[model samples]
Target: MRIWSQCVKELAQFLRDRLTVALAFILPLLTLFIFGFAIRLEAKNIPVAVQDFDNSPLSRSYIERLYATNQLQSSRWDGIGSPQAALDQGIAKAAVIIPPEFSRRIKAGETSPVQVLVDGTDVNNARVIRSSIEATTRFFVRNSQLQTNPSLIQVRSRIWFNPGRQESLYIVPGTCAVILWIYPSLLSSIAMVREKEQGTIIQVYASSLSAEELILGKGLAYLIVGLGIAAVVISISVIIFGLRFAGDPTPFLISTPIFVASATMFGLMVGTRVPNVTTAVQAVATTGFLTALLLSGFIYPLSNIPFPLSLISNIIPTRYFIPIIRDGFVRGTGWLGVWFYLLMLMLLCLLLFNIARRNLSRMQLPD
Candidate 1:
């Protein structure tokens, strides 16, 4: 792939300048470390898939009791098929299996082991699921004393399309979106600005290449870099975070390039406006990175933002991009849930490209 060449180029550039070495490697790692320690969102509305072998009144009652806690929600099992299948498909966070003798043992003054297989990819959420199960089991045990009824109805609810509440499910996709967007754009910005500082941009101004061609060519190169970044980041996420695809990978597969192109154009826009590499890098680091990270709902909800800044979030590409990514990995609704967001990403990409094209065109001087 072109990424190999790009990597070699990047290594050469970093070797040529120590400042480039710090910018290329150190900054990105710091960003990831900051994200790791700072983010601690509370878990709620977690989906628990049920495979009740007992299918008895007591088992159904336990399911109902678990759902009542509000911390745990129902998955798509509907009392049929393997709970493991749902977990494998990313349709549930935790699976509960009640053994055949569950009710009989409880009624006979014996304890029963209700199997709970939790998705451990998200360690914190796994802990929450375990705690919620224990508490609900205790509550159900206490409540059973007063109920003489021999029958109980199942409690079934929670986003019907499917579910998985692993923090990595939500975290990886959004984090990838931000990383893919910011890094490619930052690289593009720095490259173009570095060329300007070296006076090589004058060669482009005198060449047959139009402004669109020049900008598009630069973006195309970095787009390859962005996709490479995606592969490495996603692979790392899968190995480290244990995240898996929740649905058809088609939507995510198609949209990544479009999202990266928009990001590259955005960086080119900065390079076009600023005369120096330092200003271009700062513009990307402070304005571009902060806006994409904060406004995109990567780590926080858009609704939770203040009024003035909330309005600004609507224009942020990550605002639309994050939902599509979250849907593919966390919600498993496929294209149905993400089609609108995908369309929005396309629109934003076009908008950003037009702005970059115009800005670069304005910078060209008469011969």
Candidate 2:
């Protein structure tokens, strides 16, 4: 009961500290809100230009269908001007060029080539626009067929992991990984800095406690808080935001210890070197934010980045966790595919902990 009271008192004091409160609660929620709204992959409001040389009902109907697609916002240019002009000037994403012989070819039971000039600058959006155009064109061709015998060719599409392309499914899992990277690092770093700030670290080193044992205790404390943060985020994601949870708990269970251990070791290293809590916070923030943005395969696809940058990214531990959390949650992948990541995480923790322990054993505070 006495220990519990003391713990509660310390927690209260920690909470009352304005800076601690801001870092713990305000900044994290602010980041979550900003990133959730801004960093989406879904394309909207695709612009298209139409040049109808045939001026027939069939051609007009086809153009109408293109406008009807909610994904596309289309405009008509009634001139023989260059389709390349529309693409080059950024006036359109795609241009539909209906040749003069369109109606004549339809009447003769022949296929007329309707050229679609697409701006391939933004590849993903261009692909979606092209698909929508092709689908709409095929529909028009099928319905306008006046032949005695109708022929049809069916195309099938298969999407793995997320068939519906639900952005939340991909995003929520990736967000979970991002949260893991920052929260664990911040928590562990603060735990060490707090000990140093209170002048308890020297006594801890002077005592019989081994570096490994000290690290373990610190790891357990921060692990409890990290799990609490995960639970809160998960609850918000599932109950408030309606994100799905379709996978086994094995990945989450397995990754938590590795993440916490790595975080604790990193914190110890930072704490031992930086003189005060403020400097430690600065160090962690610089390391945490840049590492996540550049190295975690979140913003840019790892394969697309330059070879040298990719090599550097491979060394960031967060890179491993992002894929693991994403695969487990979105793809429902079992341990078979991601065991290598788990192993890598374990190795990182061991290496960092060894260095941190050595630093802690030799370090003395400056007067």
Candidate 3:
């Protein structure tokens, strides 16, 4: 009954703390809006250089088709230099090289390979541009040969995992990871800070509640609160925002505790060191936002980052959780695909929780 009373009192106090309430409610919406605009895979307004060596109608029509896709916005060639110069100068993502005898080669039923020099700097974008170019060229070739052969093969392409490429689906899962990164800190930090600020932590310091019990109690309190917020966000993401949840909820259910535990311990560590509320908020915000945007596979894919940076990111809990969440939701991957990440998260949580408890137990208060 005493523990129940203490829990209820803490809940009420949590409700009354304006900063806590604001963080718990208002901040998630703000994140949703910011990230909704940032995570995009489809490229628009890509620049290219066209080298029309043949000076034929076929070449002109192909160039017009590239423009018609509405993907590349601007294209140019000085006609004084090779397409390689354009690519080297970063003036073009791709250059279309048409051979001088392209028309004659096609008429004679000879395959004259039209070289497409694509900038492979961004593998995904390069693939998109190259695919579009080849697709257009293939269509022209097929139609031209149809009169001679009388039979043409039709081609169809099926896109998996975000067929429409709606930014919402990608951003929502990333947003969930970002929220987990910051909210756990906000939840755990405030509770401990309030105790320190209000002169109540001293009672626990002098009592028989042991360092582990106090840490567990505080962590459990924040976990329940954090999960409530997570549930609200998930409901909003799925039902209100129309983001799909393709995989079993069990993965999320299994992994969230581990994520929250790591985040909570990290927050407790920060809370123990900070002197005021503003700094606490700032510490969590800076660490959380940077970790989510840079270290986690949210704004950039892990493979795209350099080798050393990628290794550093592995230590970040979100680095593990984001892939699992994305895989579970977007790819509909089963537990087998995500168990490794889940294990990493659990191990990190255990390590952090132990460290936080040790630190909290060591914090000295007035006798």
Candidate 4:
């Protein structure tokens, strides 16, 4: 009954607080809308330099095919000495060099290799450019040869996860991860700081309410709110953006509360250390936003990050949870595949809760 009353009190306070209301509801929606449009995984409108030395009809047709895909655009590089020079001058993201023998090799039924140079400054864009060019070239070759040779071998490819490679499908789950961490942590910490500002924390300390009870009460209130926010954002992703969940919801269902608890406790710990609401919000933002964005394998894979940084990512709770959400929703991995991450989330939740409890126990009343 006491815990329930505390939770109700926290809920009422959350409702009354404008900052908490904004953080809980408005901010998540705004972030979802912004990131939904901004973070695109698919590469589009990439400029490419074409050096068609062959001056053949086949070469011209191949260049047209590249443009038809809308992934690559031909860059104007009339004065460029070589495809490599065009790349050096940043005239294009990639360059295609078609040798003079390209058509002759095709006519003689011999394998002809085309030289492709890509600017590796952005590795992801470079990979996309290389893949798009290769796919276009293969399509051109297969179709062009089919007219003279009916028995030419043909290859078919299919993408299993995220077919058609929709960027929203890839980004929304990660955005959910980022939002979950930032908002719950920010709101929970601010709630604690608000208690200090209103001089209610001393009353809380003087009461018979245990630290665990206080923490659990505050955390439970935010947990329910966070889950509701997550559902709304996910529905927006599914209904509006057309994201589909491919796997069982059990893994995601099990991990979400654990993730939320960890985030809320992290905020509580921050609130205990910081003197005011502004400091707490800034702390939560810096810690939650940066870690979720950079270290959680959201934008970049942990495997690709350099040695010690990769080692450091292993400790971030979001690092484990992101895969759980991605696999359960996107890749459709069963429990056997995701059990490790689930266990890690549970352990992280325990650790964070323990630290927050200790911090709460040691909290000093404002002077």
Candidate 5:
């Protein structure tokens, strides 16, 4: 009964703070909008410069094939003397230099080398441009009279997951993990710290509530709020962005509460350590947000990160939850496949909640 009363008081306090209420409701949607629209992984319509010194039908044919792929767009650099000039002036991301002997070399069954110059400024864009140019050139050679060898090996490729390569398909599910990590911890940490800063915590301490009851009450309030925000953001992803859940939603349903519990308890731990709301918010932003952003495989894969840094990612609870969300939602994998991740999340919840309970119990109460 006392715990229920404390829970109600926490909810009332949370509802009364206009700033916390606004952030609790508004921040998650705003974050989803920013991540959905602003950040993009796939590059398209890369501008390319074609410098054909041959000026022959073969060179023109090659240039036409590049445009047909729809990945590269030819840019006219009139009076730009050379392809290098176009590249130097930022007129094109890539340049194709066809030698005067291109057709003759091909007709004579000799090796013909075409120089492709790519701007290395943006590594990802440059890699895509190089691959597209190579694929297009290979396709042209296979179809043209230049291919005389009957024994030459040919390769066929197909992409499995995210076949259309839509960036949103990869990004939206990850955004859910990022959003859950930020808001739950931030809101709960600020809520607890606000009570400390305003001296309201003394009243609660004097009300004969046990430390465990106090922690559970505060955590329950934010857990409900966090879950509600998650539903809104997820609905937006499905309705607005068309995010699909391929796997059984059972694993996701089971894992989310565990993940949310860890986040809320983490915030409680932060709240107990910090002296004021400002410090708590900053702590959550720097520790929770940055750790989830960098270490959770949201922006970069954990396998790709080098040792020591990669070692740090192992402990981040968000790291475990991301795979659960991606596996259940994007890959449609069953519980057997995602059981490991769910287990990790459950263990983290237990650990964080235990630590938070202990910390809250030890906090010095005002007389």
Candidate 6:
């Protein structure tokens, strides 16, 4: 009865604060749209300067081939003496120079060297540019009667799952998980700390309400709020991004509330330990948001992280949940693939709730 009463009171108080209510609903959707549209893993339309000193038909064909993939575009190096100047001035990411003998050598069935300069400022972009140049050169040599002897081995490539290469299929589900993790924890942390900041927690210490009831009650309210947030953001993602379930949604449906409850419990623990609401917010932002963003494999694979950081990712619940959500949209492996992760997620949630219960127990009146 006390748990129900406390839950109602928290819900009522939450609804009364218009700003908090708006933050709960509005901010998450905005984050979803911003992250969905803005982030891209592949680099495209990189500008390159082409100095074709040969100016022959073969060189012209090669230049056209370079731009055929839509990955590279011609960049102007006006008032510059050399192709290198374009890179120095940041006008282009790469420069290609064809020698005078480029056409003659190739025509005589001899290898011709073309000087290519790439900006090393961003190593990944530089790698992409190098690969593009190499691939295009290989295509030109193989298909344009430029190779005197054809290689004995012919390669045929096939792309598996997500052949259309819709990036949203890769991005939106992970974004949904991150949004769900961060916002509920932030809101619940604020609710827990607000009572302390305003000195209203004295009543709890004086009342008969057990620490379990208080934590469960407040967490229950915020769990409902988190569910509502999830529904809105997920529906918007489906409508905007055309996402549909790839596997059994049963696991995703079962795990969401457990994940949200853990977030609320994490917030409650922070509020219990911190002196004020500001510190609680900062704690959640640093511990909750950063871990989810970097360690959870939301943007990159966990194996890519260094030894110690990779170890840290193991404990991040988001690490476990991202695979589940991604499986829901892209992999469709079903429970056979994701059951272990689901179990790990549930264990982590229980751990978080226990920690919060223990912390709040120290501050409450004895039963």
**Pick by lDDT: which candidate is best?**
6
lDDT of each: 0.78, 0.73, 0.78, 0.83, 0.85, 0.90
Going through the candidates in the order shown, the clash numbers are 0, 0, 0, 0, 2, 0
Q: Provide the lowest-lDDT 10-residue window in model 5.
A: 145-154
* TM-score rank order: 6, 5, 4, 2, 3, 1
Instruction: Give the clashing residue pairs of candidate 1, or none.
Output: none
Q: What's the distance in Å from true for residue 244, model 6?
A: 1.6
Residue-pair clash count for candidate 1: 0
Model 2 clash pairs?
A: none
Model 1, 235-272: lDDT tens per residue? 76677777678788888888888888888888988888
lDDT per residue (tens digit) for residues 1-367 in model 5: 7777777888898888798888987988999999988888767788898888888898889989999966899776774688889889999898999999988888789988999999999998999999999989888988785777755665678887667877787788888888998899988888888888888888777767777888888888888888998889889999988888886898998888888888998998899889998899899999899889899998787888888889888878999988888876678877988898888888888887888778777774644
Which regions of candidate 2 fall more than 4 Å away from where they truly are? 1-13, 16-18, 75-91, 131-154, 190-210, 275-279, 365-367
Quote each prediction's TM-score.
0.64, 0.79, 0.77, 0.87, 0.94, 0.96
Worst 10 residues of 2 by lDDT: 1-10
Cand. 6 Cα-lDDT: 0.90
Please write out the lDDT profile of model 4 over residues 77-185, one tens digit for every residue: 7844877887888888898888999888878878778888999999888889888888887678667763455456656779998777788777888888888888888
| Candidate 3: segments with Cα more than 4 A from true spot | 1-6, 47-57, 74-135, 146-167, 304-307, 365-367
lDDT (tens digit, per residue) of candidate 3 on 1-367: 4444455666788888887788786787677666765666778778888878888887677677777766774466576779889899888899878889987777677777788899999998999988878877767766555235645765678879878767677778888878876887777886778788988988888876666777776776677777777777777778755876687868878898778777887787788778777788888888766877788888788888897878888888988888877876788776978999999998888887788777887785534
In terms of TM-score, which candidate is strongest?
Answer: 6
- lDDT computed for candidate 4: 0.83
Q: Which candidate would rank higher by lDDT, 2 or 5? A: 5
In model 6, which regions exceed 4 Å deviation?
none
